[model samples]
Target: MTLSSENCSEFQYQVLQRSQTLDANCLLFLIILGKMLLNILTLKMRRKNIYQNFMECFCISLAFIDLLLLVNISVIFYSRDFVLLGMRFTKYHICLLTQIISCTYGFLHYPVFFITCIDYYLNFSKTIKLPCKWQKSFYFSTVILIWIFVLAYVLGDPAIYQSLKTQGTSPSQCSVYVSVQGYWFSFSMVIILFMAFVASWPDIYTLVQAIRITSYKNETILYFPFPSHSIYNINSKKALLPRFVICFLGTWSPFVLLQVIILLFKVQIPAYIELNIPWLFFVNSFLIATVYWCNCQKLTLQSIVLPRDPFVNWKCCFIPFTINNFEQIEKPISIIVC
Candidate 1:
C-alpha cells in the first residue's frame, strides 16, 4: 500500500532531523576526545615545568583555551530545547555565546604560536640577551594582554549584532546566520589568514636553518659546559620548534585556505567540507596535544638520564643524527674534544 503525501513528508522530515542529530552527536564525541587528550598533555606539562618555561606555559594556556572552545561548541550543538546544568538558556543565547567564545579562542591561537616561535628563536639562538626573570615577566604579561584583546574584539560589534537580533524572539524561533559573502567578513578572513601565514614564517625559517646547519656535517655535535656542581643536565634540551610548527601548519592551513576561497570568491562550500570542518578542528587539537605530550616525554627521559656518559654527552644533545661509515670516518680513532 502506498503512503499518503502527508505521511511521506512527515517521514522525510523525521529522517532529516535524525540524520542531523546523529551528525551533531558524532562531532561532539570527537570534540570530547580531543579535549581529553589535550587536558592530559597539559596537566603533564604543568606538573613537569610548573610554568617555569615559556613554552610549557604557552602549551598549557593553549590547551585550556582549546578545551573551552570545544565545550562551547558542544553546548551549541546540543542546546536545542535542552537544559544545561539546571539553567535553561535560549538556543539563540547559546549560539551567540558559542560564536563569541570560538572566535576569541580561535584568533588567540595565532598569537600563541607566533610568540612561542619568537621565544624559541631568541632562547635557542642566544640572541638579545635578557635576564631570565625579565623574560618570564614579559611573556606572562604578553599572554594576559593577548587574551584580553581577543575577548574584547570578539565580544564587540559582531557579537552585539547577533545578540540584538535574537532579542524579542522566542527561544524556539531563535536561529544563527553568518553572512559569509559580506565585504567586511571576507576582508577579515583574508586578514586572519595573512596574519597566520606571517606568524608561521619565522618558525619555519628557524627550523630550516637549524636543519641545514646540522645536515652539512656527518655528525653535528653540541657542547654545553654546565657548572660542575649542577646535578641536572640542562644540555640535552633540544628545541622541538620544527615539530610544533609543522603540526600547526599542517592541521590549520587547509581550513584557512578553504575560508579564504569561500569568502573571497563568494563560493558556497561543499556539504562534505561543511560536515568535516569541525572534525578538522578536532584533528588539529589532537595533533598539537600529541606534540606537547611527546615533548613532555622527551623531557622526562632527559631528566632520568641526568649524568650521561661524558664521551657521548656532547653528541646526545644533537638533533637529526647521521650514521657514518668507516670510509667517512678516515680512522677508527675516538676523537675526544673538550
Candidate 2:
C-alpha cells in the first residue's frame, strides 16, 4: 500500500493520514451502499409508474449512476490486486475517479432544474397536454443529455483536473469529494429556502392559529374534527398560502438547518449523500411550491395538474378543495388548487 512520494515530508504525511483516510473511506462506502439499497427498493416499488413524473425520470438515471459508483468503489475495496489491462489498480486512481464522478454529478442540478422548470411551465401555463408517451421520451432525452453534457464538461474542465492532481500529491482530506458547484448549489438552495421561510412567517402563524389537527400523519394532519369550527374557512386565500408554508417548513426545516451548518463550517458532502432521495424529494416539494405560488390563481384540484407527491401530501394545502368550490373556482381560481 506504499505510494511513491517525492519527499520525506510527503511520505510521512501519508503514513500519519492513513487511519483518517480509511475512516473517511469507510463512511463513504457505507453511504453509497445505503443509497444503492434504498434506490433499488424504491425503483422496484414504483417501476410501473416511474415515467409519470419528471422527478421519477431523473431517479432512473440517478439510480444507474448510484449503481455504477457503488460497484466501482466496491471493486476497488475488495480486491487489492485488481488490475485492468497492463496497469495495476491503486487507491489514488479510485479516489480520482470518485472525485471526478462526484464533481460531474454535482453540476447536474442546474440542467435538471432548468428542464423541470420548462416542463412545469409548459404543462401549467399552456392549454395543450402532452401525451404520456411523448412526456416519457422528453424526460428520457433530457436525462441522457444531462449525463453526456455533465461528463463532458467536468472531464474537460482544467479546474477539476488540477484539484484532483493536487489531492493526489498530498494527504487528501476526504476520501469522497464535493465539487465547488455542488457546495454552492446546496448553499444557494439553503438561502432561497430561508428567504421563502421568512416571507411566509406571518402566514404560517395565522395558519397555525386557524386550523386544529388531530395528529401528525399526512391524512390526519389536514383533517378537521366534527362540528368544530376554526377561524379559517379553509376556503380563504389566507389559508392557501399558509398551508404551503407549513408543509414546506415542516418537511424541509431540518435539511435547511443541515445545509446552514454545512455552509457555515464548510462540510464536504459527497455526491451520493448530497444528491439523494430525501434531497430530491425536498427539491420536488420546493418546485411544486414554487409553481403553486407563482400561479396561485390557477389552482383547482380537478382542473389543474399538480403531480401527486408520494412523500409530502401537498393536496392538504387545499383541504376543503371539493366539488362544492368547483363552480366558484371555475369562474376565478385561487392560490391553493390541485
Candidate 3:
C-alpha cells in the first residue's frame, strides 16, 4: 500500500509540472503574437496614404489598444503570485483590472468594423462625398470622444466600481466574474449585443453591394478591350473590406452571443467556454494583423509596378495643314487656258 501511494504521488507531480509548462508556453506565444501585430500596424501607420485615411488610423489605434490589453493580461497571468507596489494583488484584483480594460476597449472593436463598412459605402457610392480638409479632423475627434465616453461610463458607475472592489478571489483561478444579478452587468451585455448586431447589418449590406459591383465589373471588362487599371485597384481594396468584416464577425460574434445568453438567462457557462472566451480577442487581433500584412504586400507590389496611362492608346496622329493662295491657283488655270 505504501509503494502504490508513492507511485501515485510521483504521477501527480509530473502532471502538475507539465500543466505549468504548457501554461507558460501559451502565455509566451500570446506575447510574441501581440508584438508582431504591433510592429505590423506601426509600419502600416507610417505610410502616407494609411496615415491620411480615417479608417486605417482607427484600425491602427485599435491594434495598439488591443496590444496593451494583451500585455496587461500577460503581466497579470505571469505575476499572479507576486506582490506589486508593496501590495498583494489577489486574483480578484487581476480579474477586475482585466475586465475594466477589456470593457473599455472591447466596445470599440465592433464599431471599428461598422466604420469600415461606412468607409466602403462612401468609396463605392456616388451620392455622398466627404471633403478632404475635414476628413482627418472629423475621424480623429470621433475616436477621442469615444474613448472619453467609455472611460466616463466605467468610472461613473457606482455599482460596477463597488462590485470590482468587493468581488471574491478564488485561490485556484484568476478570472473575470460578472454578477448575474447586477443590473448594470445585464444592461451592459444587452447594449453590447445590440451594437454588434447593428454594426453587422451595414456590413452585410456592404458585402452584397461589393459582390454585385465585382460581378458587374467583371462582365463589363469581359467585353471591353481597354479595361481601366484604376477600377482594378479600387476593386482590390474593396475585397479587403469584406474579408475583414467576415473575420471580425467570426471571431467576436459567438463570444458576444455567449455572454448575452449567460447574462440574460442566468445560465451557467461551461468551464471550458468561460476559460476560452478571453482568447477569442487574441484570435481577432491575429486575424486583423494578418490582414495588415496582406495589405502591405499588395502595397509593395503596387509601388514596384507603374500603372498604365488610360489615354496612352488614344493619342491621335498629327497631320500637317497646307494653305494655297487663290492667286497662285488661278495662274495655273490661266496658263492651261492659253
Candidate 4:
C-alpha cells in the first residue's frame, strides 16, 4: 500500500486507535487478575482475621465494579472499532452494559475509597486496635454510612446516568474524562483525593511511630546486628509499606499533577502527554502490585509452598510450625503439619 497524505493520516489514526484499545484491554485484564489474586489472599487471611476483613471485602467489591467497567470498556472499544472498520456492531446491548457499569463504578468507587480512608483513619486515630473484636463493628458502621451516602447521591441525580448514556455519540468519544456527568464529576474527584489521603495515612503514622520509637529508646539495636542511631534505623525492614507508598506517590504523582495542571490552568495538554496518561496508569497499577509483592512476604511464601500442601485449607497452608521445647514428652508428639 503506497501512502498518500490522506492514507497516512488515516493510518496514523488507526494506529493510535488500536494502541488505546490495547491499553484498555490489557489494563483491565491486569486489574482483573490482580483483584482475583488479592481476593484469594484475603480469603486465606480470614482464618483468624488478623487484618481488616471489612476493608478487604470493600476492596474486593470495588475491584468487582472496576472489572465490570473494564469489560464494558473493552466491549465498547472493539465494537466501535468494528463499526469504524466497516463491520456491523450489532450490540446496542454493550451501550446499556457500559452505562450500567459506569453508574456502578461511579456509585461503588466512592464507598470503597471512603472505606479505605476510614480503615486507615480508624487505625490512625487508634479507634480500633489490631486483633480487636470492636474493629468489625466500626468497619460495618462506616461501610453502611458510605453506602447510604453513595445511594442517596447517585439516586438523587437522575441526570448522571442519562447524561452518560447520551454523552458518547460513538465509542471513540466515550470516556469518564469527557462524560456528560459534567460538574458533578468534580465532586467525586474530591472524594478520590480524600481517599488518597486516607490511604497514605497509615504510612504517615508508621513514620511518626518510627520516629517516636527511635527518639525514646537507646537499647533498640536498629535493624541489623550492627549499631546505628536507633531512632534512625529501628526495624528498617518494617518501613516497607511506608517506603512503598512514598515510591508509589512519586511514580504516579506526575500524571495526577498533570491532571491538576490541565484543569486548573485550562491549558491544552499535548497529544503525546495525553497518550502517556494510559502508560502512567499502567505504571501506577504495577506499583500497587509491586508493593504487594515486596511487603507481603507471607503471600510470596504461600505462593511458593501452598501448591504442595496436602491439606487444602488455605488458612493453615501459610503457617509454618516450629517447636521450642519438646524434651520431656512421654509419647511422641505428632506435629500439626500442614
- The model with the greatest TM-score is 2
lDDT of 2 by residue, 268-291 (tens): 777746787667766776887777
lDDT of 1 by residue, 102-154 (tens): 44544544465456556544543445766768867877777778878877875
Give one digit per residue, the lDDT tens place, for model 3 in 39-145.
56544434242224445455455556556656655676667566779977643454556556544544444454455445533433324566766877777777777
For model 2, the superposed segments whose C-alpha errors exceed 4 Å read: 1-24, 38-51, 85-87, 126-128, 165-176, 213-239, 321-338
The lDDT for every candidate, in the order shown, is 0.45, 0.66, 0.43, 0.42
Residue runs of model 4 more than 4 Å from their true location after superposition: 1-50, 66-90, 103-111, 128-152, 167-338
Residue 236, candidate 3: C-alpha displacement in angstroms: 22
Per-candidate TM equals 0.40, 0.75, 0.38, 0.36
Residue 227 C-alpha lDDT in model 1: 31
Question: In angstroms, how far off is 323's CA in candidate 1?
Answer: 20
The TM-score obtained by model 2 is 0.75
Give the least accurate 10-residue stretch of model 3, judged by summed lDDT.
Answer: 313-322
